[model samples]
Target chain A: QQPVQSPQAVILREGEDAVINCSSSKALYSVHWYRQKHGEAPVFLMILLKGGEQKGHEKISASFNEKKQQSSLYLTASQLSYSGTYFCGTLGGSNYKLTFGKGTLLTVNP
Target chain B: DAGITQSPRHKVTETGTPVTLRCHQTENHRYMYWYRQDPGHGLRLIHYSYGVKDTDKGEVSDGYSVSRSKTEDFLLTLESATSSQTSVYFCAITGDRGNTEAFFGQGTRLTVV
Candidate 1:
């Protein structure tokens, strides 16, 4: 099954912070994150495989809670360039397919 | 920029006609996938291949077919396109398992009238 993302949409100003959460009912082996600009393909952000592993890319960071079957992405000091839709893809058990979350649209303005 | 490229970046076709989207990868990854993105549904997998001639259907595979006769190429075909099939299609490649991060192509926007 596909993972569920919270806060369908969010708005932020420059230097503001926001969090996007993804949750799945089944245990996850890994969670992958990506960002898509308008009219473009999604770009890979980061992947969290190990339990409790956190990765960062510039002002973006993400944490995975294996026990909770959930992951959270943090956007710190958001910038106008960060305005895009974020999606989380999850793989569980022996499933070879990566199920994607609904997605969260984030708009950052000056 | 995983050396992945999709052909026919944009296409408009008539309903009931057959269309094919091609994805080429230079990295020679073992796993290749085809996914379609819609307004609120995000991206949904259509089909994938673990190796040459080995393929499996995904959640939204109806009306869609995929072929991977070689490791470096994966093709998605719409046999009798419909208006509902109009969307952006992405091709991705992964390493050993599905848990690994996938590299995506720019995508092809297909419009069926």
Candidate 2:
């Protein structure tokens, strides 16, 4: 099943903070985060497998709530490089195949 | 980079013509996938192969077929291309099944005119 991301698009200033939420209708075994720039392939950011778990990468971090079938990605003190579409991939159902969400477009301006 | 390469980074084909996209990998990963990215659909899976000679359909498999005859190569074929098939296709590879990083290729921008 595909996850739903909130705030299809957001604008932020440099050094600002933002949060992207990913929700699913099915039980998830793992959740993944990826960032893609304009005309570029998506790059992996982080993965969360356990409930109530929080993981960070540089100024970006994410939390997974298995019970609620939701995950939130937090970008703190955003930078110009953080402007891109953020996607959340979930592995559920009977197989490990990941279904990604529509994605959240984050634009950080100077 | 994960040593994944997609051929024909850009292609423009006529409708009703058959088209095939190639994906090659040097990482020798066991799992490979084909996905198309659109404006509102994000990334929709076309097909995937877990091993040589083994393939399965994805959510958007209509008009598309896949074959994996070798460990490093996966091919996606469109029997009769249509304008709806115009999208950027990406090939991905991953070694592990759970909590592992998946690497993506540069992507092939295909236009069916």
Candidate 3:
């Protein structure tokens, strides 16, 4: 099943912060995050393992909660380059197939 | 970039026609995936292959079939296209399942009329 993402859309100033949450009904073994710009491919961000560890990419970071099957992406001091659609993908059970959330549109203005 | 390429970046086909999208990778990854991107649906998995001749259905596998005859290529086919299948298709590759980052192709925009 596809994961659910909160705050379908968010607008932020260049120096603001934002959070995008993803919740899955099934137990997740790992969570993957990607950012896609307009008319471009989705770029890999960071992957959180099953240990509930936190991972970071530059100023962006994410935390995974194994017990709740949820993950959140945090963007601090958002930059104009951070403006794009963010998708959270979940891998459950032993299946390698990744299921992604509908996505959260993040717009960072100057 | 992970050396992934998707053919026919833009395509328009009539309803009930068959269409095939090709994904070629030079990274020699062990896993390949097909996904469709819709306005509000985000990116939904259609099918994936673990290795040559080893394929499996995904969340939205209906009306779609996949074949991997070689390690470098994975093909997604729509046996009979429909208007509902019109969406941007992407092909991704990963070195490991859920253990590594996935690299996506440029994407193919398919329009069914």
**Best prediction by lDDT:** 3
Chain A (candidate 3) TM-score to true chain A: 0.95
Most DockQ-accurate candidate? 3
Relative to the true structure, how large is the alpha-carbon lDDT of every model? Answer: 0.88, 0.90, 0.93
Instruction: Give one digit per residue, the lDDT tens place, for model 3 in A6-102.
Output: 9899999999999999999999989999999999999989999997564548678888989999999999989999999999999887777888999
I-RMSD for candidate 1 = 1.5
C-alpha DockQ of every model:
0.69, 0.73, 0.89
lDDT of 2 by residue, A40-106 (tens): 9999998888655444366678888889999999999999999999999887846757778989999
Lowest lDDT 10-mer window, candidate 2 chain B? B94-103
Model 1 pairs whose backbones collide: none
Residues B1-113, candidate 2: write the lDDT tens digits.
Answer: 68999998999999999999999999999989999999988888889888999888888999999999999999999999999999999999988764577889999999999
lDDT per residue for candidate 3 within B1-110, as digits (tens), equals 68999998999999999999999999999899999999999999999998999999899999999999999999999999999999999999988678888999999999
Q: Interface root mean square deviation of every model, in Å?
A: 1.5, 1.1, 0.7
Higher-ranked by lDDT: 1 or 3: 3
The TM-score measured for candidate 3 stands at 0.97
TM-score of chain B of each: 0.97, 0.98, 0.97
The reply for model 1, stretches above 4 Å from the true place, is A54-58
Candidate 2, residue A21: CA error in Å?
0.7
For model 2 the local lDDT of residue B101 reads: 77
